[model samples]
Target: MFDSEIRYIISSGQRKKPICQNIVLLQQWLLEQGRCVVCGSFLTKGEKKPFGTGLKIICSCNQVYFYLPLANLYKRLSQNLYKL
Candidate 1:
């Protein structure tokens, strides 16, 4: 999943600002890292799945979506979009 630095960012309540307005860039960064955007410890996401089920994203570490709002939004959107 996520790395130590990303975990710290997530835990510290400092997650602010969107990582990137352009989802494409965000996606690229995630694929490059090859981990989960949501911390490995996230309870609601289910299993030890490594981000993206059949969606366009491949989020990993590097603290891209430390902003919970953005991460959640992307996940939600991707889930919905994946169905289509």
Candidate 2:
């Protein structure tokens, strides 16, 4: 498994429109499985993109946000497993 640091940034444009910027270490695995965790929409991973080291997840609703680390995802999964 590949371990990399991921970071996210939210920007508000002049029109009050919100845009998300993600910077993370590029990994082949993440590039291959391009899908938003919240919306289940396909995400794009650009190569050699110097924005910084993680995956960016965006949704059309603009009501969802993810600020957790990758480990947190696994942690949540484990917690749910106990309930099953």
Candidate 3:
């Protein structure tokens, strides 16, 4: 099993900002899901936006996540492992 820690930085326009941390658990749970947790778009990194950029995951809870090129949904699932 592969495990990695992920960190995200958000700008609040001011000097103060918020930081979020998460762990990426590479396991079969994600592999068997076979669908985007945010959107059921077949979870392919090849998917692109109309503007010719990579597609992003927009959750119903208003959370925005991005998947790296050629990455699968498993990579994006790491975001859900965050503890706020």
Candidate 4:
């Protein structure tokens, strides 16, 4: 179910457009899996963390993943540009 959705999103025009919605869907599916895709430890949403110019999610096994809304990513990048 989730795999098909993910595949559809990937094979579609998702990347060319904003990806937040698709990313959220993928995240939900990953969480529903109930285990880390990496070390296989039980997966839990960690405290908000950073990933490049976006926010990320961390698992119990310390695997970090890119997980930010498109709006947030744009806002974050704009803010960082101002800091320079």
73 Cα displacement, candidate 1 (Å): 21
Error of 4 at 56 (Å): 2.3
Tens-place lDDT digits, model 4, residues 1-84: 775564554535454323566666555555456445556554345545566665655566556544445642211123333222
Number of colliding residue pairs in each model: 1, 5, 0, 0
lDDT of 2: 0.30
Shift of residue 26 alpha carbon in model 3, Å = 11
TM-score of 1: 0.21
Off by over 4 Å in 1: 1-19, 22-27, 40-77, 81-84
Error of 4 at 11 (Å): 21
User: What is the per-residue lDDT of model 1 for residues 6-56, given as tens digits with 9 covering 90 to 100?
Assistant: 434342377533334444555545534443444532323332223344323
RMSD of each: 14.0, 17.6, 14.8, 11.1
lDDT score, candidate 2, position 62 = 30
Which regions in candidate 3 have their CA more than 4 angstroms from the true location? 1-53, 73-84
Clashing pairs in 3: none
What TM-score goes with each of the models? 0.21, 0.22, 0.26, 0.31
lDDT of every model, 2 decimals: 0.37, 0.30, 0.39, 0.49
**lDDT value for candidate 4?**
0.49
